[model samples]
Target: MPHDDDHVPRRRARSVFVDITPLRESPAFAKLWTGTAVAQIGAQVTIVAVGLHVYALTESTLAVSFVALWALGPMILAGFVGGALADTYDRRRVALVTAIVAWVSISVMATIAFLDVSVTWPYYALAAVNAAAATILGATRGAILPRLLSPQLLPAAAALSGITMGLAITVGPAVAGVLVASVGFPWTYLLDAVLFTGAFLGILSLPTLTPDGPRRALGLDSVLESLRFLRHAPNVRATFVWDLIAMILGSPRVVFPAAGALVLGGGPITVGILTAAFAVGALLSGLFSGPLGAVRLQGRAVTLAVAAFGACTALFGVVLLGTGLIVGPGAPGEPVVPAIVLACIALAGTGAADNVSAVFRTTILQTAAPDDVRGRMQGLFYVVVAGGPRIGDLVAGGLATLIALWAPPLIGGILILGIMLVLVRTARGFMRYDAHAPTP
Candidate 1:
């Protein structure tokens, strides 16, 4: 009896960690996850390196910013088209081709840097191409995920993806900073090309995954069909709307730099710490997400998680306001340690909350949406993921300039809390969404 009782607690302890059933039971998904994780980290490294390289070449912040701007339009367009293609053809083949395109773009980017090319247009063009390809790859991979894992295991799979993204964002940029300082731009780009090849192996290992539904011809009409389907997918649409609420109103990343400079008083180092704190929170949340798998009311879970995000964002603003009042506007580089600590804690809370929301939001989409339109739905998801923060940045920056450093987040957070409560009340279908019978 004693031994059996001891084993109970042991099992409970083990269950607190992320569930590895998807990895153990699905070899194809395991390979795909591993490959995608490695490739994403490498892609992040190149993204950071490109920004730093452009800054080095032109010594202009605007020039560095334009690299992202150049990619945005192409990424959105390619994502929709890629989704159509994935729904029409074998997803594995589509992913492989897009990976090849991305790899080639990276290779050319490396070659240009190796030859000591002074012009910047090549880098810009290559960055745009790589972004488009990557957007397509992401949409295809998302579509492939449902086909690989059983619906019951999908929440766990989503948690694993969160870990992948956390590592990619945190480790990748840190590695880029090290590589760029030790080697040069050429070697950094070359390393990305090498890391990118991992994606091809994952793609090759998969069996053909053609859509198991009515196939549409790949064209504008196919993309239009996806949009039309969205009109009916209230649950899916609610998921996207909830995501936008968290990202647009609760995202405080844009304020980090200015906060560090004027409010926090730690300068660039403080900015870096604030940035990494969010990723650390996300990583930790994924690590202990095993309990989330048993959750049946995933839609309500998402709503609750995002509500926490809004609260945390508001709390972060309060921290900034408190720190600013204590430090005043004159002391830029001499931030009190406690103020910084408090601010990091709030940002970390926001990250943790947002990550939980994401796992359920993604699971809801994967389990509810039909296979034929899953790719396009995922494409819209990628667009939301990519575009929301940019919009938030603009909103935050504009509000800060017009009001105060702490105004945007404080106001935005209040808006999110109010709006989300309204959404939960009115979105009856979404609020009652059950994982077992996912309907959208």
Candidate 2:
């Protein structure tokens, strides 16, 4: 057996952030990261604002469900279009354009908030536009990363991303709650606009990245090329499918506001706390992830981490069950959540597990795929990572109304654990994926 020291390559590989102060050496990545970190917080704020506003206006969970269902189709369409664009153009430019479009859309949303609440159509339209734009930005920005760093550092970069996401989700919702409480929706939207400006600075600073092979502009041909590429790559398919399954069954984000309002008894504070706790868990896990670079068993790592996430999600469901049993469903007028601490802890565990899975998944994509096709592949990856949650939002929204808030996660978690086992067992080839030896 190869001992730990013997297993690790001794050639002193450079990290993804590079050596020049992790900022000066890779200003492009730093800029992009900074923009994303700030924007993610803003996103959380808007998410809270929209959910609260909708619930406050209509006082029905089904109305809030419409927000997610409304955005789903446009997002799916954008995924294919975005993937093609990522492969065809300079990814940084693509990201910049999308960010600008999204920024403008959010600005429009802020302006509309000044009008009547009955004007709901504009909110839905603007939200869909922002979702589509965000999808595009996510795909292209992911494709740009490999150009900015060497292969060995991909794991470290993934860890850094997880840590950032954890912090963003953690801080953003907490701040969003406070802001919504004090400043109201317009300022929240305005701040999101300002933070979005940083995204342009990052993308504009990047080096040009022309396609390696014959460059086709975004259209049917680009989509066909991406489809053809996917046909031969089982690992890529597995990665995307695994991600979708995890998010579909395990993500509980959509139920949070309702959980706070109905089950937990604390209202918005509980909602923000629960979401932020998830990020806090992710952030904490990343700090001890120093040896992540040495873990060549990425396939197993992703599998186990996802499993842990499912387990925690199930625990969150149990918290819901306890809330129902110990406290019963709240009266019609009550909007406060109960047993919030337990809920937060469960969410934190889920976030940490999901972050571990994400680090492995990102490294696998960056290391395995060729640079030429990587843009499109990462685009699909973004679709899976992003689109799945939207699907989860739909699932959570509908199911919470059908059965109860607890039913969606309790059932979803069980389904995730079962499906993951079958998928991993059937695709054992993925278990031995090697970063140094890329395969289809």
Candidate 3:
């Protein structure tokens, strides 16, 4: 009996580290992961480039923030329509088609930048189009994952996604800052357009993944059905609510430009470093994510992670506040080393915590939801994921204009912490949620 118990403990110990079995076992998953990891680097470059470009053109933080605002409506619509389509059609085809559209949009942006159009509206319009197509691609690709891998591997897959995201944000922004400063914005956009092809290749290699259950026609009725299902699914609904609260309150990307220019000061390079710092934390966390998969109480984990995220975000705000007090406001061309270091540490903490929350949240959604409605749920999930940041952009941008640059995050962080506590306490079911027996 003692020897048998020792075997169980050994197996449990081994389960603490990230399981790469999914990648090794599924060729399709490997291709998808590799392609996405590469493509996302380009995507991050474009994201940072666009913000820097807009800020350079307009010199307005509000204008830079509007990039996300313009993309919001189209993204929400795409999430709904594309998710429904993913459920009704072959997800692989859907992803491929949307990837082409995104590629074209990025190509157009490159052309405009190269031509030195000097107008900001075109950039905003093209960005919206790109965002819409990306949202669809996101929805379709998310729905395709469960089909490609086993349920038990979903947590590991989510951890891998953290690595993908972490690497993309970490490397892409740092590179984009250099490219924007050296070669300029047009080249940055062009690089993304070329990199976008990796996603296409990945999708192309995927086996046709159609919905598993009774097929529902893609239309208003199908969308309505998905919404109805979401209405009753308390645990899943809690995930969305908690995530939205955290993002809307704690999202600080909109202010990175302002932080670099007016606060932290190394110009575009500072923005890149600040952005990359967060991903560094996430990347490190993912790399060491051996213990996360073995945890059974996913809900409790999410709550704890998000709480940590809120605290870190609040600390970030404080760092900015200290910078302003010590270094003084107004754009100083040179960087403040101490403030930058402190801010980076705080942002890294936020990244680590957020990644942990994301792993569990994604695992819950993929495991609990049935295949028939999974696409639609994933679509809604995409909307929450995408829209929350935009809303934060608006909140941060609008507030910063009225108050100090650091004010929005300071207030928002406290709000996130308070709201999340209330939400978790009220929703008892969510607190007790178990991965082995998921409740959608």
Best by TM-score: 1
Model 1 has an lDDT value of 0.89
Expressed as tens digits, the lDDT of each residue in 1-440 for candidate 1 is: 37777799899999999999999989999999999889989999999999999999999989998999999889888878888888999999999999999999999999999999988889999999999999999999999999999999999999999999988988998999999999989999999999999888778999999998776788889988999999999899988989988788877788888888788877888998999889888988999999999999888899889888888888888888877787776655577788889888878888888899999999999999999999989999988888888888888888888988888788888888788788778877888999999998
TM-scores, all models, native as reference: 0.98, 0.84, 0.88
Ranking by TM-score: 1, 3, 2
Q: Give the alpha carbon lDDT tens digit for every residue of 1-440 in model 3.
A: 37677799788776666678779988999999888888999998998899999999999988987898899889999999998999999898889889999999999999999999888999999999998998889888888888888878888999998999899988897789899999999999999998988897679899888888888888999999998998998878878888988888888887888899888889778876887788898998887787887889888888888988998898889988888888875776589988899999999999999999999999888888888898899899989988888777789888788998888878888787777777677767888999889988
RMSD of 3: 3.7
The residue-by-residue lDDT of candidate 2 on 1-440, one tens digit each, is: 86888645542343322222334457778887777777877776776677767776779878877787788788878888887888887776788789889999988888777654555667778888998898888877777877887776677777877776777677776676687789887787777777777667777788887657777866888878888988888777767777888898887888887777777777766776887788898988776666677778787778878878888898899898877777675632453344677787888888888888888888888767777788778777766766789778778878888988898888898888877777567768787777666576
Better of 2 and 3 by lDDT: 3
Give the Cα error of residue 82 in candidate 2, in Å. 1.1
Clashes of 2: 7
Q: What's the true lDDT of residue 109 in model 3? A: 99
The runs of at least 3 residues in candidate 1 whose Cα sits more than 4 Å from the true structure, single-residue gaps closed, are none
Candidate models: Cα lDDT each: 0.89, 0.77, 0.87
